[model samples]
Target: MRRSMWRVMGLFSKKRQQSPSGSTSGQSCAATSTTSAYELQEKDLGRLHRAAAHGNLAWLRRWHWWLKRVSINRRDKEKRTPLHLACANGHADVVSFLVQENCQLNLTDNFKRSPLMKAVQCQQEKCVAILLEHGADPNLADADGNTALHLAVLSPNTAVAGLLLEHNANIDAQNQEGYTPLNLAVSKHHKEMVEFLQKKGADGHAQDQRERTALMVATFAEDMNAIQLLLWHGADSLIGI
Candidate 1:
């Protein structure tokens, strides 16, 4: 039973990176527009989505004649809006323009992830800050009940996590699996993130759906640094799983 429980924890800790369709991670302007089949093609995206993803400010300008036919907030097949694409691709200018046009800030994509969630997931600090400054709600949960802060813990980007916390993201927000950001940080063996979260007042004794405490999870992973941090925060060592 103990081994099985650890296996379950492993599965939760190793979440796959789910990017939007027709999107590639780490693609830059220098990459040839059609060098490889896997590259994102302009035809695959709607006019607004492509413009936003590529940060084509000229096409997105308010005076463009084609603007009459295209809705500024148009969504593609997967229910991803121009804002979602812009945020995910770190197109800060496009994001700012969209925001100035008063596009919906909290619209969810097919996976129920908002633009702010995508910004954090993609490590777009500029976009994240822009969204937060313009009244984006940091506490909105995605399809998995994971808030922006929850997604922030997935990477070592403590700066992004700190920005989320500054915008009043719930430090103790739990996903559907009942894992808080601290639990996730410990599971991933991210000592810096664990310490950062603790400084932000995450509940050290928080438990998952299985009633497994953060300390218990840390112990299962044998992350001594996390264990010490949790212990220092007054996590009950004698607590049973």
Candidate 2:
């Protein structure tokens, strides 16, 4: 009787193991058809980005539904929709389509950098123009209060700064550290940008909590040109000291 019970228990265990395996496989299969609520991985996302950048209608045709879902999904840690990636890579048509689909206009990444910021940071002038046409805010800042103007200021390109200014970006905007775009130019000793920001209303007198104005910052490594430019721009010699 004991032997007979052992045999019966063995059969039951075997059947239970097989049942669970079959159930799990069916669930996975069901999930695939149930629509992927998951955000694409970086690799998968890269594929979409490449396709959008090229404006390959055929590639888009093959992945349109999936791409659309990604463009609208706000579930990622970065909070970036497909438009953000496309804009960063300068995909004009992709940007237009997403706007038509009503993708979130101001989605920010982990750094509080918006799609518009990405476009500007990468110096994608055409994409920037498209975003502006789609109503992207020229003054949108990162988490640190660094606006698109701030980004342009950080970069060495005066043209990017000029483009942003022409789009009505605030020249006097300060970061969390209170460093205005002019301050950044001075800190980096970017002479042309310093001139441009000053002409565009960048306040050279702006300072951080450490009492460092752009002029004071220019004093860091013996930059006479930046000092002269800041002075020429009306920077107070003792303002931040």
Candidate 3:
């Protein structure tokens, strides 16, 4: 009787082990299927982004009707849409078409930079104008709180800066560091930009987070030309030590 009981117990243990193993295999297969589906979706989105960035207008037009199905505004892992890539790469035609398709004009990327900011960063003059003409916001700041005008001044692109100013970008816009466009120009010793910002009504007397004025910053850098321009603009030297 004892021998008979042992044989029954062994049979039960073996059946239990086999059932669990089969279930685990099925689960693993399901998980792999789910992972593959996600990868395919990412690849589709990446293809769209690459098409825009590379100026493949043919591909874009061929798939124009399918844009709504895949969502033209769908962002990648970095939250950058096709419009962002097109603007950054200076694809004016792509940008124009995308704009006509009613793509979000002010959609920001992961870094909170709008399409206009990307255009300015890449110095795409025509792309910048196209975006501005379609009413892209010039005052949207990036993750660093630097607006398109701030980047233009840093780039020393007087034409881009002028365009942004004409569109009502804040002349005295301050970044996260409280440094205005003029302050940035002064620090970078961009004489032309400093003059342009001052003419556009950028506050020469604006103080940074550390209470340092443009004139004070120029003085510290010992930039005679910057000092002269600031003084001419009536930048207060006594304040912001």
Candidate 4:
């Protein structure tokens, strides 16, 4: 996949060089592809949305200057940095470059979510992966006392959850409602998430200050799969699973 992505971009590298205005470097790349009939610009913001959404190492590595000159400092009406855009859209290579070019990592705009937080919030799993590898603090909680782990489990994004956990996030971390990630997943009826956490040796028997165990929460959600999984994993029989 990576090689093919690069081959396409490399094929067009020279033709892309003649435009001196540099208005939008690497603008509408897919438009000219032999396989693609239409131009990307004729579309909506979804043009950039799709390209910038990929953690495209091909685009970043081949078009480093283009991305820097064109991609840097661009933002939407909400005043988020391009870093925020990259994070929200799951552009890890763009993210790494933006970060290398000194894009603000913790720059919180209207929503108070850093690029890292936004990545997790939007389920940009790869961006979350890259951000964690690039030193995003997993323990960083947001306004609602929700950690990245909290959101990961809610989405039941196993890869993101595992990546966050590998970075030493507090597994039993609680939120504003005293709901742990376990609580959130159980409440959402995410059977796989519950079982994965349990396999990771997560104390399903432990509750937040709210006295809600994973089994109790799963029972409330009527998640029989999660309930069964929790029971087999040594969750206290004293609870409601």
lDDT of each: 0.74, 0.64, 0.74, 0.62
In angstroms, how far off is 129's CA in candidate 3?
0.4
What is the per-residue lDDT of model 1 for residues 1-241, given as tens digits with 9 covering 90 to 100?
4443444345333322221311211121111112111124667787788888888888889555676566877877778888998888889998998998888999998778899988888889999999999999999987778788878887568999999888888999888878888887777778999999988888877777757677766655556677677767766442532
Give the per-residue lDDT digits (tens) of candidate 3, residues 78-158: 788889889887899999999998999899887788889888887899999999998999998788788988888767799
Worst 10 residues of 2 by lDDT: 27-36
Task: Provide the global lDDT of candidate 1 against the true structure.
Answer: 0.74
By summed lDDT, the worst window of 10 consecutive residues in model 1 runs over: 28-37
Q: Candidate 3: where are CA atoms >4 Å away?
A: 1-45, 236-241
Which scores better on lDDT, 1 or 4? 1
Question: Model 4 segments beyond 4 Å from truth?
Answer: 1-79, 237-241
TM-score, ranked from best to worst:
1, 3, 2, 4
Candidate 2 lDDT by residue in tens digits, 115-232 = 8788777677777777777788888877767788777665566776777777788888767767777776766667898888788777776775456667655554346677667666
lDDT for model 2 comes to 0.64
True lDDT of residue 198, candidate 3? 82
Judged by lDDT against the true structure, how good is candidate 3? 0.74
> For model 4, how big is the CA root-mean-square deviation?
19.9
In the range 69-187, model 4's lDDT, one tens digit per residue, is 66555554555665776787666677777667665566664545567777876787777877777787788766667777877876668888888889898888877666777766776
Clashing pairs in 1: none
Residue 52 of model 2 has an lDDT of 54
Top TM-score model: 1
